[model samples]
Target: MTVIVRDFRPEDADAVSRVRRAALPFEVTTPRSVLFHVESANPAGKYRLLIAEMDGEIVGTAQVGVAYESGTPGQSYANPQVHPGRRGQGAGGLLLRTAEEHLAAEGAVEVYAWVLDEPEFRAFAERRGYRPTRSAHFQRLDLAGGTLPELPARLPPGVELRTAADYTADPRPMFQADAEVTSDEPSDIGAELDDYEDWLAHTWNNPLLDLGLSTVVLVDGEVAAFTAAHTDGERRYWSGMTGTLRAHRGHGLAKLAKTDSLRRARAAGCTDAFTSNDAENGPMLAINKWFGYEVCATEVRHVRTFG
Candidate 1:
């Protein structure tokens, strides 16, 4: 069977979502979210979604783009996913090659990808000159059956809780908070959130982002901590980001926002909760452990530099 790689079409949302779910079950994805990503991507990102078709059926897909928000140039990312049942058909390799070629044409000097921490997956990446840098764990919680901690009786003085929806008039504060926290995150490639308009178009307006379910903590009327939530509108939910501003590190506001969001998610009938954390983030990892979230899978960030 001949495998062909091509750009994703609007009608390929289902197939693309299916491939991603099969490849990375810990994350929640939907057809609408897939289309929204394609539609809202900034041109500076040079984003491209490609699918691998075998006999007119899409069996694999990849998202390739430059890290437009990064302070450094030539940093790009491409994550390719093949259906579990369709592995070994050369579709994954084709998708990866297509993605890399596209990024290279766009002047990307270094490309990064996430590979499952299994032996085979690591070998696949190593064979293509990608070297593993850091690892992260995908954790899951049984929100429906497990008991969650009760919200604190009273927040610390000068602290209050709110949601992203509360900032309907202006989201610049949230953007600034996100940018500050994101710059300090541990990762293989460094990134800085530089564009407010791009962040709004891609993250703030994402269909899966439940602003009402996302909790933010305010200390003295400043955005001090936040837990961003994303959902598939059914049984699955994800913590997009849980971060604390620099000045509020030890106050447990991050935990407060996360717990409040998780409680709201469970109350809304979300059965499963998922989050990813860098292996080195001890504080966040400990917090997740307290919530009964267990590590289900791991992925290593891998990078390849063009000669």
Candidate 2:
């Protein structure tokens, strides 16, 4: 069977989403989100969504892009996935080669990809000249059936909990908090969140973002911590981000934000909750563990530098 890789078309949304969800079940993805991601991608990212077809059926997908927001130049990423049932047909390799060619042509000096921590997955990447680097975990919690700690009888004096909806009139505080916390997040490519308009468009306006379920913590009218939430408008909810400002760390505020967000998600009929974090982030990992989140899968970041 001949497998061919090509640019994603508007009609490929459903197929692309299907392949992505089948391959990475822990992440939240839908046809709408797929389209939005492609359309709203920052111009400088040079994002390309590729689809692999075999005998007229899409069996694999890849997202290739320059890390324009990264402080370092020439850093790019290519994440490819093939449907489990279609893995042996050479679609993944073809997609990878196509994505790499596109990235290299776009001036990428190095490419980073996340490969499943499974032996075969690691071997595949290694054979392709990628080397293992840092690792991250996809954690899940049974929001509907599992036990969740009761909310503190009373939040610490001067601390208050609010939803993202509360800032409908003005989201500057939330943006400020996100910028502060995100700047400190552990990432191979540093994210420079200096553009408020970009944040408002790509983040605040995203369709999957569940404003009502996202919890924000405030200390005396100032944003301290927040847990951004995303849902498929059904049983699945995802913690888009959970962080506390540097000045507010160690007060258990991050935990508080996540806990409140998860509870609100459960109340909204979400049956499962998902989140991920860098393996080295002990504080967040411990907080997730406290909420009974178990590691569902692990992905190791792999990098290949072009000579």
lDDT scores of the candidates, listed in order:
0.93, 0.92
Which digits, one per residue and each the tens of the lDDT, describe model 1 over residues 1-307? Answer: 9999999899999989988998899999999999999998889989999999999989999999998777789999999999998988999999999999999999999999999999989999999999999999999999989989988897779999899999878999999999989888888677788788888988899999999999999999999999999999998999999999998999888889988999999889899999999999999999999999999999999999987
Among residues 3 or more apart in sequence or in different chains, the pairs in candidate 2 whose N, CA or C atoms overlap within 3 Å are none
Give the clashing pairs for model 1.
none
TM-score of each model, in listed order: 0.98, 0.98
Steric overlap count per candidate: 0, 0
